[model samples]
Target: NLVPLLVPLFVSAFRRADELAMAMEARCYRGGYNRTKMRQAVITTADKVAYLLMILFLAGSIASRFIHILV
Candidate 1:
Protein backbone atom coordinates (compact mmCIF):
# COMPACT_ATOMS: atom_id res chain seq x y z
CA ASN A 1 0.00 0.00 0.00
CA LEU A 2 1.02 3.60 -0.56
CA VAL A 3 0.42 4.11 3.16
CA PRO A 4 3.43 1.94 3.96
CA LEU A 5 5.56 4.10 1.69
CA LEU A 6 4.23 7.33 3.26
CA VAL A 7 4.97 6.16 6.80
CA PRO A 8 8.74 6.19 6.27
CA LEU A 9 8.55 9.47 4.40
CA PHE A 10 6.70 11.08 7.33
CA VAL A 11 9.19 9.62 9.77
CA SER A 12 12.05 11.05 7.70
CA ALA A 13 10.32 14.44 7.59
CA PHE A 14 9.87 14.62 11.39
CA ARG A 15 13.45 13.42 11.95
CA ARG A 16 14.74 16.13 9.65
CA ALA A 17 12.71 18.78 11.51
CA ASP A 18 14.14 17.70 14.85
CA GLU A 19 17.69 17.73 13.43
CA LEU A 20 17.12 21.23 11.97
CA ALA A 21 15.80 22.52 15.30
CA MET A 22 18.84 21.24 17.18
CA ALA A 23 21.19 22.66 14.56
CA MET A 24 19.49 26.07 14.73
CA GLU A 25 19.64 26.12 18.53
CA ALA A 26 23.33 25.22 18.54
CA ARG A 27 24.10 27.87 15.90
CA CYS A 28 22.22 30.52 17.88
CA TYR A 29 24.12 29.65 21.05
CA ARG A 30 27.43 30.14 19.25
CA GLY A 31 26.33 33.22 17.30
CA GLY A 32 25.17 35.15 20.37
CA TYR A 33 28.77 36.05 21.21
CA ASN A 34 30.65 38.99 19.65
CA ARG A 35 27.39 40.52 18.42
CA THR A 36 27.27 44.31 18.26
CA LYS A 37 23.95 46.10 18.32
CA MET A 38 23.52 48.53 15.44
CA ARG A 39 21.59 51.20 17.30
CA GLN A 40 21.46 52.26 20.92
CA ALA A 41 17.81 52.74 21.81
CA VAL A 42 16.73 55.72 23.91
CA ILE A 43 13.30 56.78 24.98
CA THR A 44 12.52 60.43 24.42
CA THR A 45 9.74 62.88 25.43
CA ALA A 46 7.37 61.65 22.68
CA ASP A 47 7.48 58.09 24.00
CA LYS A 48 6.58 59.32 27.47
CA VAL A 49 3.66 61.29 26.12
CA ALA A 50 2.36 58.28 24.19
CA TYR A 51 2.63 56.02 27.23
CA LEU A 52 0.68 58.48 29.39
CA LEU A 53 -2.02 58.79 26.74
CA MET A 54 -2.38 54.98 26.61
CA ILE A 55 -2.76 54.78 30.37
CA LEU A 56 -5.36 57.54 30.38
CA PHE A 57 -7.34 55.74 27.66
CA LEU A 58 -7.29 52.49 29.61
CA ALA A 59 -8.49 54.19 32.81
CA GLY A 60 -11.26 56.01 30.96
CA SER A 61 -12.46 52.71 29.41
CA ILE A 62 -12.57 51.04 32.79
CA ALA A 63 -14.44 53.93 34.38
CA SER A 64 -16.98 53.97 31.56
CA ARG A 65 -17.61 50.25 31.89
CA PHE A 66 -18.10 50.52 35.64
CA ILE A 67 -20.54 53.40 35.18
CA HIS A 68 -22.53 51.37 32.67
CA ILE A 69 -22.68 48.40 34.98
CA LEU A 70 -24.17 50.54 37.76
CA VAL A 71 -26.81 52.02 35.45
Candidate 2:
Protein backbone atom coordinates (compact mmCIF):
# COMPACT_ATOMS: atom_id res chain seq x y z
CA ASN A 1 0.00 0.00 0.00
CA LEU A 2 2.67 2.54 1.10
CA VAL A 3 5.18 1.31 -1.54
CA PRO A 4 2.89 2.36 -4.39
CA LEU A 5 2.52 5.82 -2.74
CA LEU A 6 6.28 6.24 -2.16
CA VAL A 7 7.31 5.41 -5.77
CA PRO A 8 5.50 8.40 -7.31
CA LEU A 9 6.62 10.65 -4.39
CA PHE A 10 10.26 9.74 -5.01
CA VAL A 11 9.91 10.13 -8.78
CA SER A 12 8.45 13.64 -8.33
CA ALA A 13 11.26 14.62 -5.92
CA PHE A 14 13.96 13.46 -8.39
CA ARG A 15 12.23 15.32 -11.26
CA ARG A 16 12.18 18.55 -9.18
CA ALA A 17 15.83 18.11 -8.21
CA ASP A 18 16.81 17.67 -11.88
CA GLU A 19 14.93 20.86 -12.81
CA LEU A 20 16.64 22.81 -9.97
CA ALA A 21 20.07 21.53 -11.09
CA MET A 22 19.37 22.59 -14.67
CA ALA A 23 18.35 26.10 -13.49
CA MET A 24 21.48 26.44 -11.35
CA GLU A 25 23.65 25.18 -14.25
CA ALA A 26 22.11 27.77 -16.60
CA ARG A 27 23.11 30.50 -14.07
CA CYS A 28 26.73 29.13 -14.03
CA TYR A 29 26.69 28.27 -10.30
CA ARG A 30 29.85 26.13 -9.85
CA GLY A 31 30.24 26.93 -6.11
CA GLY A 32 33.67 27.44 -4.41
CA TYR A 33 35.37 30.66 -5.65
CA ASN A 34 32.28 31.44 -7.75
CA ARG A 35 30.38 32.29 -4.51
CA THR A 36 30.65 35.60 -2.62
CA LYS A 37 29.27 36.36 0.83
CA MET A 38 26.96 39.36 1.19
CA ARG A 39 28.40 39.93 4.64
CA GLN A 40 31.86 39.14 5.98
CA ALA A 41 31.94 36.59 8.83
CA VAL A 42 33.29 38.16 12.05
CA ILE A 43 33.54 36.27 15.35
CA THR A 44 32.39 38.35 18.28
CA THR A 45 32.54 37.81 22.05
CA ALA A 46 28.98 36.41 22.10
CA ASP A 47 29.88 33.88 19.38
CA LYS A 48 32.91 32.76 21.40
CA VAL A 49 30.77 32.30 24.51
CA ALA A 50 28.16 30.32 22.55
CA TYR A 51 30.84 28.06 21.06
CA LEU A 52 32.41 27.50 24.50
CA LEU A 53 29.04 26.63 26.02
CA MET A 54 28.28 24.19 23.15
CA ILE A 55 31.65 22.45 23.62
CA LEU A 56 31.07 22.22 27.40
CA PHE A 57 27.58 20.80 26.83
CA LEU A 58 28.86 18.15 24.40
CA ALA A 59 31.70 17.19 26.74
CA GLY A 60 29.25 16.88 29.64
CA SER A 61 26.96 14.71 27.46
CA ILE A 62 29.81 12.32 26.58
CA ALA A 63 31.03 12.25 30.19
CA SER A 64 27.51 11.45 31.42
CA ARG A 65 27.28 8.47 29.03
CA PHE A 66 30.63 7.11 30.28
CA ILE A 67 29.69 7.70 33.93
CA HIS A 68 26.41 5.86 33.36
CA ILE A 69 28.19 2.93 31.72
CA LEU A 70 30.80 2.68 34.50
CA VAL A 71 28.22 2.72 37.25
Candidate 3:
Protein backbone atom coordinates (compact mmCIF):
# COMPACT_ATOMS: atom_id res chain seq x y z
CA ASN A 1 0.00 0.00 0.00
CA LEU A 2 2.33 2.75 1.28
CA VAL A 3 5.27 0.80 -0.18
CA PRO A 4 4.39 2.01 -3.67
CA LEU A 5 4.37 5.61 -2.43
CA LEU A 6 7.96 5.25 -1.16
CA VAL A 7 9.31 3.53 -4.25
CA PRO A 8 10.04 6.75 -6.16
CA LEU A 9 11.73 8.42 -3.21
CA PHE A 10 13.90 5.38 -2.56
CA VAL A 11 14.87 5.12 -6.20
CA SER A 12 15.84 8.78 -6.32
CA ALA A 13 17.95 8.45 -3.19
CA PHE A 14 19.69 5.35 -4.58
CA ARG A 15 20.49 7.21 -7.80
CA ARG A 16 21.87 10.16 -5.88
CA ALA A 17 24.03 7.84 -3.78
CA ASP A 18 25.46 6.22 -6.90
CA GLU A 19 26.22 9.64 -8.41
CA LEU A 20 27.94 10.76 -5.20
CA ALA A 21 30.10 7.62 -5.15
CA MET A 22 31.16 8.24 -8.74
CA ALA A 23 32.00 11.84 -7.93
CA MET A 24 34.12 10.77 -4.96
CA GLU A 25 36.03 8.24 -7.04
CA ALA A 26 36.56 10.76 -9.82
CA ARG A 27 38.13 13.27 -7.44
CA CYS A 28 39.99 10.59 -5.39
CA TYR A 29 38.50 12.41 -2.44
CA ARG A 30 39.62 10.77 0.80
CA GLY A 31 38.09 13.47 3.02
CA GLY A 32 36.63 16.92 2.96
CA TYR A 33 38.97 19.18 1.01
CA ASN A 34 39.28 22.84 1.91
CA ARG A 35 38.56 24.40 -1.44
CA THR A 36 37.67 27.98 -2.23
CA LYS A 37 34.94 28.98 -4.61
CA MET A 38 36.23 30.83 -7.69
CA ARG A 39 33.17 33.05 -7.67
CA GLN A 40 32.14 34.71 -4.44
CA ALA A 41 28.95 33.03 -3.29
CA VAL A 42 27.57 36.08 -1.55
CA ILE A 43 23.95 36.74 -0.76
CA THR A 44 22.94 39.28 -3.39
CA THR A 45 20.08 41.76 -3.14
CA ALA A 46 17.77 39.37 -5.05
CA ASP A 47 18.63 36.55 -2.65
CA LYS A 48 17.85 38.76 0.36
CA VAL A 49 14.53 39.76 -1.15
CA ALA A 50 13.66 36.13 -1.86
CA TYR A 51 14.64 35.05 1.63
CA LEU A 52 12.53 37.85 3.19
CA LEU A 53 9.53 36.76 1.13
CA MET A 54 9.99 33.13 2.16
CA ILE A 55 10.21 34.09 5.83
CA LEU A 56 7.11 36.26 5.59
CA PHE A 57 5.14 33.47 3.90
CA LEU A 58 6.27 30.90 6.47
CA ALA A 59 5.42 33.20 9.38
CA GLY A 60 2.03 34.03 7.95
CA SER A 61 1.19 30.34 7.48
CA ILE A 62 2.32 29.47 11.02
CA ALA A 63 0.34 32.36 12.55
CA SER A 64 -2.77 31.42 10.58
CA ARG A 65 -2.48 27.78 11.61
CA PHE A 66 -2.04 28.73 15.25
CA ILE A 67 -5.08 30.99 15.14
CA HIS A 68 -7.11 28.26 13.44
CA ILE A 69 -6.11 25.70 16.05
CA LEU A 70 -6.93 28.06 18.89
CA VAL A 71 -10.33 28.91 17.49
Candidate 4:
Protein backbone atom coordinates (compact mmCIF):
# COMPACT_ATOMS: atom_id res chain seq x y z
CA ASN A 1 0.00 0.00 0.00
CA LEU A 2 2.70 2.46 0.91
CA VAL A 3 4.71 1.39 -2.12
CA PRO A 4 2.27 2.95 -4.56
CA LEU A 5 2.31 6.23 -2.68
CA LEU A 6 6.09 6.37 -2.29
CA VAL A 7 6.93 5.43 -5.85
CA PRO A 8 4.89 8.27 -7.36
CA LEU A 9 6.21 10.76 -4.83
CA PHE A 10 9.78 9.77 -5.58
CA VAL A 11 9.21 9.97 -9.31
CA SER A 12 7.64 13.42 -8.98
CA ALA A 13 10.50 14.66 -6.84
CA PHE A 14 13.05 13.35 -9.33
CA ARG A 15 11.27 15.04 -12.22
CA ARG A 16 11.15 18.30 -10.28
CA ALA A 17 14.88 18.05 -9.60
CA ASP A 18 15.54 17.49 -13.28
CA GLU A 19 13.44 20.52 -14.15
CA LEU A 20 15.34 22.66 -11.63
CA ALA A 21 18.66 21.53 -13.06
CA MET A 22 17.54 22.33 -16.57
CA ALA A 23 16.32 25.76 -15.50
CA MET A 24 19.63 26.50 -13.85
CA GLU A 25 21.48 25.46 -16.97
CA ALA A 26 19.28 27.74 -19.08
CA ARG A 27 19.82 30.75 -16.88
CA CYS A 28 22.21 33.52 -17.96
CA TYR A 29 23.53 35.73 -15.15
CA ARG A 30 24.81 38.48 -17.47
CA GLY A 31 21.39 40.22 -17.72
CA GLY A 32 21.29 39.57 -21.43
CA TYR A 33 17.93 39.51 -23.24
CA ASN A 34 19.16 38.10 -26.56
CA ARG A 35 19.00 34.46 -25.59
CA THR A 36 16.54 31.96 -27.02
CA LYS A 37 15.43 28.66 -25.63
CA MET A 38 17.68 25.89 -26.86
CA ARG A 39 14.96 23.32 -26.37
CA GLN A 40 11.29 24.09 -26.05
CA ALA A 41 9.73 21.92 -23.39
CA VAL A 42 6.46 20.37 -24.55
CA ILE A 43 4.41 17.54 -23.09
CA THR A 44 4.26 14.56 -25.38
CA THR A 45 1.27 12.24 -25.82
CA ALA A 46 3.35 9.33 -24.48
CA ASP A 47 4.03 11.22 -21.27
CA LYS A 48 0.34 11.94 -20.83
CA VAL A 49 -0.56 8.32 -21.39
CA ALA A 50 2.10 7.11 -18.98
CA TYR A 51 0.92 9.54 -16.30
CA LEU A 52 -2.68 8.44 -16.71
CA LEU A 53 -1.72 4.78 -16.53
CA MET A 54 0.32 5.34 -13.40
CA ILE A 55 -2.55 7.13 -11.72
CA LEU A 56 -5.01 4.43 -12.73
CA PHE A 57 -2.78 1.64 -11.46
CA LEU A 58 -2.03 3.45 -8.21
CA ALA A 59 -5.71 4.06 -7.61
CA GLY A 60 -6.50 0.42 -8.29
CA SER A 61 -3.83 -0.75 -5.89
CA ILE A 62 -4.99 1.59 -3.15
CA ALA A 63 -8.59 0.51 -3.59
CA SER A 64 -7.64 -3.13 -3.47
CA ARG A 65 -5.62 -2.63 -0.31
CA PHE A 66 -8.42 -0.74 1.35
CA ILE A 67 -10.91 -3.47 0.45
CA HIS A 68 -8.59 -6.12 1.79
CA ILE A 69 -8.15 -4.28 5.05
CA LEU A 70 -11.89 -3.81 5.37
CA VAL A 71 -12.62 -7.45 4.70
Clashes of each: 0, 0, 0, 0
Query: Relative to the unseen true structure, what is the C-alpha lDDT of residue 45 in candidate 4, on a scale of 0 to 100?
Result: 100
TM-score-better candidate, 2 vs 3: 2
Off by over 4 Å in 2: 38-71
TM-score of each: 0.48, 0.50, 0.46, 0.45
What is candidate 2's CA lDDT for residue 64?
Answer: 100
What 10-residue stretch in candidate 4 is worst by lDDT?
Answer: 28-37
What overall lDDT, based on C-alpha atoms, would model 2 receive against the true structure?
0.96
In model 3, what is the error at residue 6, expressed in angstroms?
A: 38
How would you encode candidate 2's per-residue C-alpha lDDT over 1-71 as one tens digit per residue?
89999999999999999999999999988888658779988999999999999999999999999999999
Highest TM-score against the true fold, candidate: 2
TM accuracy, model 4: 0.45
- After TM-score superposition, the amount by which residue 57's alpha carbon in candidate 1 deviates from its true location, in angstroms, is 0.2
**Listing every candidate in turn, what is its Cα RMSD in Å to the true structure after a full C-alpha superposition?**
8.6, 10.2, 12.3, 18.1
- Using lDDT as the measure, which candidate wins? 2
Tens digits of per-residue lDDT, candidate 4, 8-69, equal: 99999999999988787787433356666689779999999999999999999999999999
Tens-digit lDDT string for candidate 3 (1-71):
98998999999999999999999899887764776558867998999999999999999999999999999
lDDT for predicted candidate 1 compared with the true structure: 0.93
Worst 10 residues of 1 by lDDT: 28-37
Model 4 clash tally, residue pairs: 0
